[model samples]
Target: MILQDFIAINEKGIYCLYGDFYLDPKEPVATAVISHAHADHAVSGNRDVYCTEATSAFMQLRYGKNAALTFHILGWQQQINIGGVEVSFLPAGHMLGSAMVLMVYQGVRYLYTGDFKLQPDATCEPIQFCQADVLITESTFADPNTAHPDAGLEIKKLADIDINIMLGAYGLGKSQRLIQLINQHVPDKTILVPHKIWPLNAIYEKFGYQLGNYQIYSRKLMKEQRQFVYIVPPFTFDSYIRATGVKRLFASGWKNLQVNDKDTLYISDHADWNDILKAIEQVSPKEAWTLHGDGNALKQHFDGKLPVKIMN
Candidate 1:
């Protein structure tokens, strides 16, 4: 209850009144504690930004040199005081450098899961659990019907096909994951990415996420008859599919899309419904609040179990 008084959702983002910092704020602020380098969570133009080293590098890659007024990099479990409140970052497991913001005020701990996944992803750090009085989480796939299948199975399908496979993924985290998955499952096939994703691969490699054998896409290679796995951002998928005449697969968690029968892979980086439930059970917070996506399902499912609120 006291923590509720200290933290509140504002127009910019979740604000810590006592700490005077914002958690993954949307707009610019004096001090921003970012969860990850995803554009939706870690926006540019904040006066001061705090995040993990990987996230800082990601920010630099995405936002350029002038991403923030100043940067304060924090390691996992490394605590720093701001406005007399102890704050730290924990691994989120969503992607490389993704983290959960933890704040301790007056001996009571509060944890915020910016965006996380329980499923294993080789391209990033594993999720770290921390107990807290209040738990704030993202409900991207909170619905009971939403469940992700094994990502390895999906990758295996791409390997079995005879023709070249063209996969569409979000450029930031998802693209890197696909590269690793493709390499692990079908090491023989050549893995190729568009120009935009090439730089991201370098960053991932710099952080020790070895994405085996891969190269940037080329028009000359496209003309060749050899089977190659081409991964591109969603925006460019349609163009590449039409020009290259390759089998297309979209990797995402959404199940109800009108994609072709064998063209969609239910591979997601966000925690599914069961994962959400497990996280709540693990945290055992006095109060639980959900944000992002449609959180009504989470509120309804945990109705009498805890004090659950669907945050807008």
Candidate 2:
């Protein structure tokens, strides 16, 4: 029972051979064990899907009847057997309902993290770690120099500006997070969201995470309110690139998405370099495997200390 024999990257996604399921498959498959409902990770047309209750709700909202033929909802830490392999989910802290897949075969544990973060977020569950023989993780911000600043301080930056703000964020996780952050830190500024994002917010609220206050976007309402933040999805934000008056800012961890020095909100849902290292330390895996971003730095850092493999 080698690590590769248990689970390895294939054309579809991170395939669990022992379980006969795909973790976050790119294309639809027979059985998909989704970590979250994000478009890139959870796609439509899968015959069967296994994920958290919140993830299932999100997928239904996003994909409707096309979400999946069957959704096998599993609570956190709940164990199930598939293809003679024991499987479970742990909080990933990346977003609401995000999970780190755990598979055990022949007494060896393999943990597959599907995008994760270490920051404290009121809108989502915090990450939980467990010891494993092989640790597979996403290295989105795995550079030695990449360290995400405190999200609280970053969100407070919105309070300094007195003008209306056109805040751009992803609809599912990021949009809801920004709404909560603005309500808690920048209460003076009214929060506005587009129609597409409103349903997702409702879903979050249904899950008992209260997002303070927000209204669906309105051109007239935006004009009436002087101190307000209008949060729009990426597509809407791009369409309004030339629109006038409001200060344009995109909330993301990527430096390139910042566009300019002033129009940047360094709020990211992905784990940074230090967070990744901390995760590895916490997991204490015999061998580390990296995906999603460059793994050379991790490989170099662990040279002679612990074996590291870069999964393509």
Q: After superposing candidate 1 on the true structure, give the runs of residues whose Cα lies further than 4 Å from its correct spot.
A: 240-244, 256-258
Q: Candidate 1 on 1-312: residue-level lDDT in tens?
A: 445567778899888999899988989999999999999998889998999999988898888866898999999999999888899998999999999988899988888899999999999999998889888889888888878999988778776777777778899999899889888987878888888888888999998999888888886786685579888787787665465467778888876541577567888999999999899888888888888878788777777978777667
Global lDDT for candidate 2? 0.91
Which digits, one per residue and each the tens of the lDDT, describe model 2 over residues 38-84? 99999999999999999999999988999999999999999999788
Q: Highest TM-score: which candidate? A: 2
In model 2, what are the clashing residue pairs, if there are any?
none
RMSD to the true structure for each prediction, in A, is: 1.6, 1.0
